[model samples]
Target: MSARQARIVHISIERNWREVYDFAAKPENMALWASGLGSGLEADGENWVAHGPLGSVRVKFAPENDFGVMDHIVTMASGLEVHNALRVVPNGDGAEVMFTLLRLPDVSEEQFEADFRWVLKDLNTLKKRLET
Candidate 1:
């Protein structure tokens, strides 16, 4: 697949960037929003893992507010490998979340679109969780 063929999703939150960032970036809080997705922070704070439909995916994060991006290598149960990047930025009133997906393994455009839709739903869930 072409590297240019990536999925990007954005969500605006109602809380300040700091609050949103701190809540979402922390491991324990992630479980609150990303329940059943196998997403959480490791006890050592060195890495985060989100279990995709495939296998246990892992990502290492820098210190908070480091402006560093987290990378994901998700191996689907069907043996498809997907690469993902997640970044959060401050926007007026709250924050903007950016998610990109690439290197889909045998994934069709329609499938990708569906994945993006699911991601948006997830983000909305997060927004509500944070705003309330």
Candidate 2:
């Protein structure tokens, strides 16, 4: 299976890139904007766990950095892993948040479109949470 489709969504937030990155990089603040994660993630030893429509999921994020990279790996209940490469970069006075969405080999076209929409929604949610 090789869907091999990729998409990137970016939103401009009225805040410093560092501030946006700091807030977005926190797992405890995920569910506040990321609807896919539902309510929130709870620390479970070295990994973070969350229960949502897809059931229990484990997530691991990249270590703290200065370049505003916020990549993360998500392990679904079904044992599937999704790698998300997210970034926050300065744009003049504010910042731009970007999320790269990948369509897995087994994902249908409809589901892929839905995922893009969800990513857009989540990015908007993040923008609102940080800009306000």
Candidate 3:
């Protein structure tokens, strides 16, 4: 079987890049905006876990840095790791947030499209929460 191509979904937020990055960089704040992670995050030793729609999943976030990189890896209980490459780049006085969604080997085109929609919704939610 051929591998599926990854896709990127992004949104522009009317907020300072640093403000958006600060809010997103913190793992604990995910549930506030991300519906998929609405169950929130819990510390589990070196890793973090969240009860997502799929089930309890482990979350590993990129270390804090000056750059607006808030990438994270969500490992499902079944051991499938979904890498979410999220970035907050400066756009004038606001910011542009982008997320790269990788299509897993077993995912069908329909499912991949649905995932893209979900990410877009989440990014919109993030924007609303920050801009308000």
CA shift of 107, model 3, Å: 0.9
- What digit string (tens of lDDT, one per residue) describes model 3 on residues 28-128? 89898888985799999878988878789998899998889988898998898888889999999999999988888878999999989998998998998
Deviation from native of the Cα of residue 29 in model 3, angstroms? 0.8
Q: Model 2 clash pairs?
A: none
> Runs in model 2 with CA error above 4 Å?
1-3
- Per-residue CA lDDT of model 2 for 50-106, tens digit only, reads 888778899988999999999999999879999999999999989999999998877
Shift of residue 93 alpha carbon in model 3, Å: 0.3
- Superposed on all Cα atoms, the candidates' RMSDs to the truth, in angstroms, are 3.3, 1.4, 1.5
Candidate 2 has what TM-score? 0.94
Clashing pairs in 1: 54-76, 54-77
Q: Which candidate leads in lDDT?
A: 2
**lDDT score, residue 32, model 2?**
92
RMSD of 2: 1.4
TM-score of 3: 0.94
Clashes of 3: 0
Question: Which wins on lDDT, candidate 1 or candidate 2?
Answer: 2
